[model samples]
Target: MGIPLDKAALVGLFLQTLFYGVFLTLYWLTLFVLLKKTGIQRQLLIPVGTLLLFIATAHLILEFVRALEAFVFQVNTLGADAYYSNLASPLALASLALYITQTILADGVVVWRCYMIHNRRLLVAILGCIVLLIYGTSGYYVVWSFSRTHPLGNTYISITIFYTLTMLISVSCTTLIAWRIYRTHRFIPKGLATFLPVFIVVVESGALYATSVLALLVATLTGSNAQYIMLTVIPPIVGITFCLIVLQVHFHVGGSPSEHSAKPRGILLRERGVRDTDFSNQPITVHITEETEIVQSDMMRGKNSQLDSEGVFQV
Candidate 1:
């Protein structure tokens, strides 16, 4: 018989798989609720969010399979070497393809929306075409890399460069847009502002890169099953946490105030028309005085009595 699996390793594997599944479930449920309530059917962030959810689901499935293989066969067939050489190759390629497609399309839509908002039709078309060309070329390269036997080196370099450039461009564009909105609106919604800072930190800190590096170091140095389990578990937890936070912020920002409040303030406007056309205009000033102190003309008193009878005016 091959080496028996450590009890602790088995427990960790089970818990990790369970946690991942829970995370994915929560994410999808939150996303569904947000979509229904917000009525924002199409957004760049939706695809990104979906991709993240997909990654988490796929990761959980992969881990579950590995755990089952170990438990049932009492063999280490799904070890690091097997993962890197066989399983990861195809998965990585697919992930890269999805990332490229989603990123390009999402970013293109954002750029197009920005241009349309600013009434830059000509520039929108030009920039849109350029985005398509860049994405097309990248897709071609990714397909070519996948077809080769030794695809890792070329694929890694291509994806790294593409992702780095895309991240930088996205960050710069989004920051500029946010700034423009702030300048024009004077008040950026609190949730949206919160999102920007968290997003900036996640991108700048290179959380994914750090996770990969830590995983590699752990796998190489100790070669322990516990380490392997921890490596698989931690990054997804962190990623899922961020995704949930983002979704929460989005939902909170999108919520209608009236829906949350029982007694919403109603706007009550009292207009005095100087002329027929002036009826459409708002009053320039409003003054409140005690009824005891104010003296009203007979005509004004009659108008006030009429208004009070109709319940159209209030002191």
Candidate 2:
């Protein structure tokens, strides 16, 4: 809780570097998947993802520079505290700006996903944009307020509100998306690329990002030095979580031949329907098929097996 500011920054920088490596790997993988699987619509997603990665890169580089200034350049002369505590320094202000930008972009992606999945409902879109507006406004105010040499006591409350709104936006949008996907999963026929996997991906990715935000919020409220570490790691986590949803959803929809062959033999006879939607900012095509045949004989079948209207028979 009382960790030295310089020490906390050092740890945060180290952890951010590690997380950035993971984010880099996932970003490249996402690119590979999108390029391989998507068509012209791929343009819709790549720029946003690339922007996030770029911000993360800038953030890490900035942290490295700041760390150098605090530990190496300033330590022997002005002392590390001088560099670490000065919120108005160019590096300090720039770092906060990057964090806010990354947060806004990441939150925008989630809201976009929500809008698309909800059939582009005007209400959803409007509300999401409104909240995003509030989030960005409050976030910048917090940044500007903190940069002041003598911030008022209410500045802490503003910071708390900023993070609270972030968590709520993520949770609410994700819940809406998950609910919509769940409904679609229930209404649609089974054995034709189940939506459950998509549901799981949405929930997991959402939870991962939300939990990181919650951790940071907790640390901030508690006045723990760990907030520095949490702050450093969140940018990369946002990228990582988004990339994961894209990769995993890509695999579930149509993965490599080996991944496909690993599943039980099932013949999809006819395409019933296909719905185009956006997932984690990527275009996803969902195929609904009718009449799937599982190629397995009844070796121990005292009960007669027959295909039902839905496709498969019970044992």
Candidate 3:
């Protein structure tokens, strides 16, 4: 038999709390790295990242409130089942809104990063448009689904589509970004191959998020109460992925050669004025600050190069 909804909800809350702690640490670390290394700029990533963290915070608070109501206050009164089954509860509605909003925003950021990294290629632009449309429409249906007395019976297909599209968005964006990195890697000087591991780590980190979403989709489609746990965990997982990219880029860009001396000869060529043949023709302004720099610089260094005699290696 499936796990009881009340018990599942409680377990989900516990797991969510654990992940939220991790997310908090990473988010603050990202901010510290940015402010310490690169002062604030016009980078679009700051506001977007802040907004996502805010949504996650609100979601966690709401989840705690719901759990309290279900297990503590309502348990002896209306009963936990009554509390969990009441889809119209303010907490439930708010949680749904936050979840959908985060989903759209997170997916949109991934697409935007891909579009920018590829120099706004028409193909990426078209894909981004399609992604936003699906997310927007599916989000609307998700909200609508809740209004139905029997949402599972009336809107299961819509819900399924929403999760499936989210998973696709994650997988597609990760694949495209990884491919771009791999292709760009071919043009980089052999001395800079040391950075390849870091790049690969970023791509693999993204793949992990995609995998998490896939698991969520599977659990959702299987009608497993475990979906509750995945749902609760996703917000933090998203934050973790975002922070991992930011931190990885920050460390490589700001780190000293002595620290990486054991690794390879050309750890970061930025200080050495080494320009790849592919980037010699491009205009490069090196900015080591901001989360977007991870994509705009490290991922596509050849297209974006340094112009100063100071020997600032681009990317």
TM-score, each model? 0.46, 0.79, 0.78
- In Å, residue 92's CA in model 1 sits off its true spot by 5.1
Ranking by TM-score: 2, 3, 1
Best by TM-score: 2
What lDDT score goes with residue 206 in model 1? 37
Q: What is the lDDT of residue 167 in candidate 2?
A: 94
Q: Write the per-residue lDDT of candidate 3 for residues 96-213, one digit (tens) a residue.
A: 7788888888888788767766656789979887977986787677677786676756466777788888878777877776666565554335524434655565566678787887
* lDDT (C-alpha) at residue 6 in model 3: 84
Can you give the lDDT of residue 6 in candidate 2?
Answer: 80
Q: lDDT winner among the candidates?
A: 2
Stretches of candidate 1 above 4 Å error? 1-32, 35-56, 59-79, 86-92, 95-129, 132-136, 152-156, 187-256, 259-315
lDDT of 1 by residue, 152-262 (tens): 666645644554455444454445444433332222223233334434432433344334435534443454445445445553554454345445433434553344344
Q: Cα RMSD for candidate 3?
A: 8.5
Error of 2 at 249 (Å): 0.3
